[model samples]
Target: MKRKHTYKLILFSAFLAVVGCGNQEKKEVAQAPPPSIPIIQLTTKTVTGFKEYPTNIEGVINSDVRAKTAGYIQKVLVDEGQKVKKGQVLFKLETQALSEDAGAAKARVNVAQVEVDKLVPLVEKNIISSVQLETAKANLAQAKANYSSIAANIGYATIRSQVDGHVGRINFREGALISPNDATPLTTVSDIKQVYAFFSLNETEYLDFLEHAEGKSLEEKLSNYAEVNLILANGSLYSEKGQIQTSSGQINQNTGTVSFRAVFDNPNQLLTNGNSGKIQIPTVYENHIVIPQEATFEQQGNIMVFKLQEGNKITTAMIEVKAAIDHLYVVESGLQKGDKIVMSGVGKLRNDMAITPQEVPFEKAVKPIAKLFRN
Candidate 1:
C-alpha cells in the first residue's frame, strides 16, 4: 500500500511540472517584439529655399581663327594647344608676290606726284589748256588710291590672333596653301578666364523667380541674379560665383525653352567649352515648412509623410511640395507649426501605428550626406 501511494504522488507531481513549463513558454511568446516603426519629431523651423536648373559650361568667347588673304604658309609660329595673346602673330605667309606688288604701287604714286606738280605750274601760267591740267590731276588722284589699296592687302597677308585665349587644333602645316574662305579652320581660340553658361528656363520658372530677383536688368521676363555656381563633369562644385548677363528674346519653338547666358569668373581656366553640369538657383522667397527626404513617401502619384500625434500614434498627411530646397523638401502646404514629423526608418512605416517616439536633435535630422545625385 505504501509503494502504491508513493507512485500516485509522483504521477501527480509530474503532471503539475508539465503544466508549469507550458505556461512559461506561453508567456515568452506573448512578450516578443511588436512591429516597431521609426518615428521622427516634426518641428516648425525656417527652411532654406532653392531650385536647381540644368546648365552647361561654355567658353566666354569662342572664335575660329582664319586667314584673311590667300597664300602659301611660309612658317607656323605656334602649334596646337598653345596660349596666345591679342594681336599675336600666329603664322607668316609667302609675301614675295605681295611685297613686289606693293613696291610697284609706290613707284606709280611717285610718278603721279611729278605729273601733278608739272601740271599745276602750267595751269597757273596759262601755258597749258584747262582740260589737259584737269586730266593730269585726275590721274594723280587715281594713282594715290591704288597705292593705298595694295599696301593694305600686303598687311593682311600675316595671320594674327584677334583674342587672348588658348589655341587649339592646327589644321595647316608649313608650305600649305590656304585661302580666305577655306572649309577647314587653321586653328581655334577660346577665352576661358571667365566662362559663359548657356541654358534656358520656361515661362513658369521665370514667374516663380521674378520676385526674388531684385536690382538687376530684365529682358523678356528673365532677370540676372547676382550670383551663380558651376558644377564640373567630375561632380565638383566650382568655387567661383557667376552673374547672369543676358537672354535671347524669342523662345525656341521646338524645345519650348528660352535661351539665357551667365558669366562665371574662372580664374584657374578649369571650365571649357561643351562641358556639361548643373546650376542651383534660389527660386522661391518665403519662410516655409521643410521635411527630411527620408520622412517623405510617395504613394499613388502623391507624396505623403507621417506625423506623430497623441499617445505616440502616427497619422498620415499629404503635403504640397514647392521645390527641393537643398537637402530638404520645401513644403508649400498640408503641414503646420509644431507638428511632430518622423525622419528616419520611413520605409517601414504605416498609418495609425503606435511607436516609442523620441525627439532627435535638429542638426541630426537636417544634415545631408555628401553623395550627390542628379535631380
Candidate 2:
C-alpha cells in the first residue's frame, strides 16, 4: 500500500509539471510584439519622366580661318578669344616677293604696250603686215593678264575674318609658314549669340519618341515638342530652356543612333563650341500613380511593394513600373490610389507578416523627389 501511494504521487507531480510548461508557452506567444513599420496611402498625381542624353555644344556659326595663299605670316593682328568684325584683317603674310614679281610683270606690260603702239602705226603705213600688229596686241593682252594675276596674289596675303565672331586658337603665329594646304586652320571663329546642343538617341528610343510624340509630320512633332532642360557639366541646371532645332532624320549605320540638335539663346556667350553637358527631355504623365522607388523591391524579375491588409498584415503586391526617374517610379498598374503601402523597411518585411501600423504623410515618404514634378 505504501509503494502504491508513492507511485500515484509521482504520477500526479509529473502531470502538474506538464500542465505548467504548456501554460508558460502560451503566455510567451501572446506577449510577443508585432513589427512596427511606416505606411503611406497612395495618391494620384501628375508625374513627369525625364530621359537624359549626353550632348555636344557648338556655336551657331563655327568657321575655320585658313590661309588662302602660301606665305610666311608677317603679323598676327588679333589674339585668340578676341572679338572680331567681318572683313577685319586677322593676319598679314610676307608679300615682299610677290611685290617684286608684280613690279617685273608691270614693266613687261608697259614694254608690250609700247611695242603695240609702235606696231599699230607701222601697220597703218604698211611698214609691217596686219598679222604682225595682231601678234603684238596679243602679247600686250597676255602681259596685262600676267600683271593682274600677280596683283591678285598680293591681295590674298592679307587674311580677314569672314564673319563677326570671337576668334579661337591661333595655330600659326608671326613668322610661321602657312598655306592653303596646311592640315590645321590658322584659327577658328565662333558666333555664340545662339548655340546648338547636339545629342543622339538609339533606334528603339527614337522609334518610341516618334510614336508618342504629337503631330502628323516630323516638323510638326518637333515644333510641338516640349522645351528641354540642360544639365551643365558641373551638375547645374541652365536657367534658360532649349528648343529642338533639327534631327539627322536617318539612323547612323555605324553608331545606330539618330542625331538631334537643340538650340538655345546664349546672350551672355556662356556656351561655346566643344562645350559638353546632358539634355533632359521630359515626358509628362497626367493623373498617374507614382510611388517612391525605395518602397518597392524586385522579386523574380517583377517589381513588388508591400501593402498593409485589414489586420495590419503586409502582403507583397506586384506593380508595373512604366518608368523610373530619379527616386520615383511611375506606376502603371497593380496599385490603387487609396491603397496603403509600406513606406520603407520593405527588405525586413515578409509576406503576411503582422506589423504595428504607423501612418505617415505621403509627401513625407517622397519628399526628396518633390521638385521633379514642378513646372
Candidate 3:
C-alpha cells in the first residue's frame, strides 16, 4: 500500500511540472514585441483625368469623282494616292460617237449659215421676203446652239477633278462603263492636309458638357473649350492638337446624340479619310488628397484603409474616392491631409490592431506603383 501511494505522488508531481512549463511559455508570448508596419502621411496631388470616346476620322473635304457623260472609260490618267491639282483630268471617256455627232452638228450649222447668207443677199436684191430671211437666221441660231451643246458634252467626256487633293481607289478602271447616273463614283478625292474627327455625345453627356462651360452662348462655350487630343488606332497619341466645333445643337432623332467635330492639321499625312481613332478630353484637378490603392481594401463594396492612431493602433477609414488615377485613388472625402495610414500588409491587419509604426515618405510609397499604369 505504501509503494502504491509513492507511485501516485510521483505521477501527480510530473503533471504539475508540465503545467508550469506551459504557463511560462504563455507569459513569454504575451509579452513579445509588436510587429513593425510601414505608415505614410496623406498628401494632396495634382491629377489629370481623361474621358475618351471613339471617333471617325475623315478629310475636311471628301469629294467624289464622277463622270458627267455616259461612256466607256477610255483612260485613267492618275494612280491611287496620286496627288493632283484642280482641273486635272482623272479619267477619259470614249467619245468617238459623240465626236461623230458633233461633226454632223457642225455641218448642219454651216449649211444653215449658207442658207441665211443666201437669204440676206436675196432680201437686199428684193427677190426674197424679210420674213424668209428672219426664218433662215432663226435656223442658223438653232444650229449653232446644237453644235455648242455637243461640243460642251465632248469636253465633259474628260472627267476632271474639281478639288486639289489625293486620288482614292479607281473603282472603274479603263474599259468599265461609267455614267453620271451610276451609284458609285469613279473615285474619291480627299483633302487630307487637314483632317476632321467626328464623335458624338449622348443627351446626358451633351448637357453636362455644356453646363460646365462658362459661357452664355454655345459659340462662346465651344470657343472657350479646352483642346482635345487624339489616340491613334495603334494606341499612340497623335502629335497635333485639335479644336472642337459643332454646327447645330439639335440632337439626332435616329442616333439620339449630339454630333461634335474636331479639326486637326495633318502635315505629315498621318491622318486620312476612313481612318479611325479615339478622342481624349481632359479634366484637371488642381489639388486633391491621394492614397495608394494597395493601402485600401474593399469591405461590403466600400473602399477602406487603415489609419494610424496615437496608441500605435490603427482604425478603419472609409474613403470617398473622386477618381482613380492609375494605382492610386483621388480622395474626395473621409481622409484629410496630415493623416497617417498603413503603407503595406493591410491584408494581415484588423481594426484597432497595434503595430510598431515605421514612417515612409509619401511620394516614395506611391510613385513607383502609380507609374505602372501611366500613359
Candidate that would win on TM-score:
3
Q: Backbone clashes in each candidate structure, one number apiece?
A: 5, 0, 0
Off by over 4 Å in 2: 1-22, 31-33, 369-375
- Candidate 1 regions exceeding 4 Å error are 1-36, 47-51, 54-64, 106-128, 183-191, 215-226, 273-276, 283-287, 325-327, 346-349, 370-375
Model 2 lDDT tens row, 1-375: 999999999999999999999999999998988978999999987877789999999989999999888999999999988999999999999999999999999999999999999988889999879999899899999999999998988999988999999998899898999999999999999999989999999999999989988999889889999999999999889888999978888999999999999999998888888889999999999988888998999999999999989888999999998888778888989999999999888998899999998999987877765466643
The residue-by-residue lDDT of candidate 3 on 1-375, one tens digit each, is: 999999999999999999999999999999998899999998888888788889999989989998888999899999999999999999999999999999999999999999998888889999979999999999999999999998988999999999999998879998998888999999999999999999988899889888987688999989888899999999999999999976369899998988899999999998988889999987777789888888999999999999999899999989898888777788999999899999888999999999999999998987844346655
Q: In model 3, which runs have C-alpha deviations exceeding 4 angstroms?
A: 368-375
Per-residue lDDT of model 1, residues 254-356, tens digit only: 9877777888887887777777877755454355666787888898989998888888788889999877766788777888867887877877878898787
Report the poorest 10 consecutive residues by lDDT, candidate 1: 215-224
Q: Which candidate would rank higher by TM-score, 1 or 2? A: 2
**Cand. 3 Cα-lDDT:** 0.91
The better candidate by lDDT, 1 or 2, is: 2
- Sort all candidates by lDDT, best to worst: 2, 3, 1
Report how far off residue 82 is in candidate 3 (Å).
Answer: 1.4
